[model samples]
Target: MQSNPGSPHSDLTLAARPGAARQARRHVARVLPGWGMAGLADTAELLASELVTNAVRATAALVAAAPGEDRPPVVPPDRLGTIRLRLSRPGGRLRIEVWDADGRPPVPRAADADAEGGRGLLLVAALSAGWGWHPARDGGKVVWCEPAGP
Candidate 1:
């Protein structure tokens, strides 16, 4: 796990792609043990995957909607945005923050039981103590959540 220099948080910046969610989960698995919260690692990793998956989908949509104009591309031609996963401890609770270059906040949709998708935020709301989002000063947004217990 790579710790961010000059900061108490550890972060992983991933390309806004399908693979990023897996990478984010792996990162959480590696970092949380050192923070002495190994017991919470499974829950944390699950929540992180859900959040990162949503962020990646949102970012891809944003890039597709706007091919040009100010939204910096993470790579040439593809116009992919960056997804940042940050881990921090505040007030003795683990804070999971996923930053993406999409201004739209996540909305939990009521998916049918047979639906194959759209349950990300539902899992988040169930597993997380609290979750919400706010627009970033530089544009885009950060979706954050904290698990219910130790």
Candidate 2:
């Protein structure tokens, strides 16, 4: 993890796996108060989880679909995916950016009351002032969102 001095910002790189979301929540919880942004912690953590979860899912899917010998080697040579989480409170808005190794952009599903999943982006939209994603020039994409009302 890397943090900027004199700023409420940090960059966390984690293995894109099943438990990454939980780790992200812990990091957010640890940083928010010191940044003087505790009020946004709950919602920020939720959004961070959703984004990281989606990223891990996408990376796992990609690895599973790749050819046996074409799969990218993970840090441990078996994990096969990576995610970078950037947390920043810039201009009075808490921005959560999750970068995954997959380039597919997330689409918000319809408001379905019966769906158990596929509602991550929907939750992000509802809880955030704005949300969107863009493909990274190097690879993959970055999904970002910010809390509502400062």
Candidate 3:
């Protein structure tokens, strides 16, 4: 991960674990304010959390479906692949991205009002200035969003 807060770009690689979402959120919380983008922090952190959570789940799902696994509650680090979070502010808009080994595009479903999950992408679209995904050069995909910034 890039350590220079002053730089326009920051990146973090995390194992595909349940905690990845929180770590990604914290990264946004730190980076945005460091870059003098505190106004974008709340939105960016939430968006980052959602994107990273999706990536972690997708990556873990792929691993669990592979041969010899009896569905462990939490994947061990040795068995877990990694997801990456890349943040940047270009042209004055904060962009958040999460990359994982799954190539499927994000599908936003019409979650029921009481549903505890499945609204990640919908929230991304509604709160962000723009959002999308693309095939990464090597493999998998990179899902990204830019929060509505002043």
Candidate 4:
């Protein structure tokens, strides 16, 4: 979560939890007030949901692997441990960035037409204007997408 020293639209971090998704939507709403973009809130909420859900699941796996004092829900405290949500309005797009504590990038699984699971990233691809991932210096990866223009 490195930020440009003087950039106002630099970086923001939010806890990774089920409820954090809703909080993220609220944050986006507050930040982009009067944007009047239809379905923007829903898109943001859905993206937040998918990303946070994945992060929580990954954290649980890490906790199970390392038995000791109850590890915090997020992992790799100084590195890949915390989930990071970065919202930026640099150009004509609303960028939603979700960072998780895993260096291995996420692969969007192809779901069968009749399948009930493995559709989160598919939804992300369908809704977002564009989406992709990048490796964080600290061994985690940031998956991000841009919403349709306002």
Candidate 5:
């Protein structure tokens, strides 16, 4: 994580592992309040965790498809690169973004009630003030959401 105490922006890049989401949640939980956006901490942490989890899953999917990539270590220590979580206040509104190597846009699904997952983006859409995604220059896509008003 790279951030200054009163800075308006902070960035964290973590290995694409199962624990990455939890790390992201902790990052958001701290950065938001440090930036005087404590009101957004809960929502930001939740949304950041969701996006990071999705990114990790996408990375793991590719890893699981490779010949010997199905190793014990979840991320294999940088084999699949990292997931970046960014927090910024654009126009005074808190914006959270997660970047991964997946270029395909996120698709919201109507999850079965009995499903154990698949509600990440749904929760994001319901909780965020506005959200979207754009292709990143580094070859992936950055999914972003605004949790606070302008």
Candidate 6:
């Protein structure tokens, strides 16, 4: 886990596991008391769930691509790989960033009338003021979205 030098706020890192996502939700809840941002607690949990789910799925695909003998270590239930979720209150807005080791950028598809698997990012875009993805220097990618109006 890399750290940003001279940054005051600490970043949260979790393995792409289901339990980790839950734990992250709980942690965010606990921290919300200090943030004092109305309705932010629920928003944090929802966003975390969506982002973690995507990370886990991507990690699973990567593991499956590797040779049987080179597969990754045992991942926790509902978790697939390493993911970093960072929350920062640098100024007026809350920045939510979810990073995974897969370098592929997510392609947001237009959901079919009856489709069930393509709505996560759509929800994110709706709730967030703005969102985008970029490749990380270490071979993975970071997808970030900011809440509207701080």
Reference-based TM-score, model 2? 0.85
lDDT per residue for candidate 5 within 72-110, as digits (tens), equals 324334535788899987788888888877666888888
State the lDDT of candidate 3 residue by residue for 66-112, as single tens digits.
Answer: 56754423334553599989999889788998988777777888999
Candidate 2 lDDT at 31 equals: 80
Off by over 4 Å in 3: 66-80
Q: Candidate 2 — which pairs collide? A: none
Residue pairs clashing in model 4 are 75-81, 76-81
Candidate lDDT values, in order: 0.83, 0.83, 0.85, 0.65, 0.81, 0.69
Better of 5 and 6 by lDDT: 5
**TM-score of every candidate relative to the true structure:** 0.86, 0.85, 0.88, 0.71, 0.86, 0.76
- Per-residue lDDT tens digits of candidate 4, residues 67-142? 6754433435564445767766666467778777765667788889999868888888888889889876666677
True lDDT of residue 86, candidate 5:
91
Which numbered prediction scores highest in lDDT against the true structure? 3
Q: In model 5, how large is the Cα lDDT of residue 107?
A: 81
Model 4, residue 78: C-alpha shift (Å): 5.2
Deviation in Å, model 4, residue 59 alpha carbon: 2.8
CA RMSD per model (angstroms): 3.8, 3.5, 4.4, 5.4, 4.5, 5.5
Question: Highest TM-score, which number?
Answer: 3
Clashing residue pairs, candidate 5? none
Q: Give the range of the ten consecutive residues with the poorest summed lDDT in model 2.
A: 71-80
| Position 50, candidate 5: lDDT | 92
| Residue runs of model 4 more than 4 Å from their true location after superposition | 1-12, 34-39, 66-75, 78-81, 112-117
Pairwise TM-score winner, candidates 2 and 4: 2
